[model samples]
Target: MTNLYRSRAMQDAEMSNSSFLPSLPSELLFHILSYLDIPDLLSISRTMHYLRTISLDPLLHTYRLQRASVILSRAIPSRPPLTELMARRVYITRTTLTALNLGRSLTMIRLKRQLERRPTVERLIELGVLPPECYLNQSNGISTTLGLYRRRKVVQKEKVRNFLAEWIGELSKRITRRMIDSSRSTRDASSL
Candidate 1:
């Protein structure tokens, strides 16, 4: 009886899940996708492999671009500028970093003291007073002399940050290119 009940529950769950995006025809799906703003379309696209392929289709983006621009135009113009965004991030990181001090070891305290004696190039970059390109010259010199474990941990942080920044820049470029192309199509559409 327990096995029979389990089978019935599994069947019901499967039946329920079978009804999502997979049920829609591609043409109809694309039409539905057209109504979404760019961000929403991106999120929905991740729901399925086919949806991802279809959402990235140029024709669909033409519609999404128009929708996103319209949505953005309607949003409040008083939203905070880039400086506020950076400050908020710094505030959050600062607060969380202080919270992280509870788990500190002696080596970690020593590292913090070492970091304090370095130049303030990273802080300048964070504040937007200096560009990220200038930050490349500011590595803490002690990582080279540290033990293997310490070196790995110290070096890993910088490596991960560089990798993340590169990928983030790539993502920004792709988004900008798509928006530019969409704006052109929008112009063509209006001219028609």
Candidate 2:
């Protein structure tokens, strides 16, 4: 009795599973499969014998190729040719790559030589190229490029702050003078 019951349950599960894709008409199924790429079609083919036959159909692949060729043919006329694009440096050929490497190497060599000949921070400070605040203190070790940059920034901020403070002081003095003159005028008018 238990064996018969288990067999009936298994049959019901199989029937439900088989009804899913196989229930669709073959033409509709092929239409849906047409949208899937090659890898996906292969995966679906592996899932069942019925799918394997449909997914592996040469007619479907031929149709897909034809569709892709039509798309390419439509697009090709709007774009430049490969040789023109290569000349414009849109595509890097072997010669272009070699020239690029050579240019990079030459730039690096020139930069290294310039760096070797560059003046020290102390010399730059003396020449007024860098601010005096960039000078090394006893507390700090050797001054770095970043340290010099920060010192110059601080000096600039201090100058701006001082200018703003002076402008505000002058503006307040003018406002006070105006208020005093306005009050005196009102008092004189009342006395008259």
Candidate 3:
């Protein structure tokens, strides 16, 4: 008798906790599901057998694809023409692309040569062109130049530190002033 009573109570609890979506008409549920993306539909399919069947319906996917095609067709006319794109160099023929690539490679080679001939960091430091802070020592006792990125990061950190210090000083002054004013008011009230 106890087992039967417990089973009935569990069934009632489950019935109360069941989702209202399942109780909705199939046509309405499918209409709602049609607005959901593929990922949402897939997630819904994993929740229940009925939803899995509905979400995986080929007709829904075909409809979505057809709608997407229609939207893309409508948007296509708003894009720039091929001639304009070609004139802007956003679109190029294969031969032109090849020529551009060759020019880029030659420029890179020339830049590499110039970089190889550039003065060392130590020489620059000695010449007063670079600051002493640009020198960095590794754990292996080898010294290296601090690249532009590291220098920028160090400068940024200093700026943040200074800003925080100034902000904290102002905040402390404001709090001290508030405390003094409150104390003076309390004293004046007591005197009255």
Choose the strongest candidate by TM-score: 2
lDDT of 1: 0.78
The models' CA-based lDDT, in order, is: 0.78, 0.88, 0.87
Model 2: runs farther than 4 Å from truth? 1-70, 77-79, 132-170, 173-180, 183-187
Compute each candidate's TM-score over C-alphas: 0.30, 0.47, 0.46
RMSD of 3: 9.6
Global fold similarity of model 2 (TM-score): 0.47
TM-score of predicted structure 3: 0.46
Per-residue C-alpha lDDT of model 2 across residues 90-168, encoded as one tens digit per residue: 9899988999999999999999999999999789988999776667765767655656688778999999999999999
Root-mean-square deviation of every model: 32.3, 13.2, 9.6
lDDT per residue, candidate 1, 55-160, as tens digits?
Answer: 8999888877887888888885867776787678744566567766755766698899999887686787788875554544435633222255466677989999
Clashes of each: 0, 0, 0
RMSD of model 2, in Å?
13.2
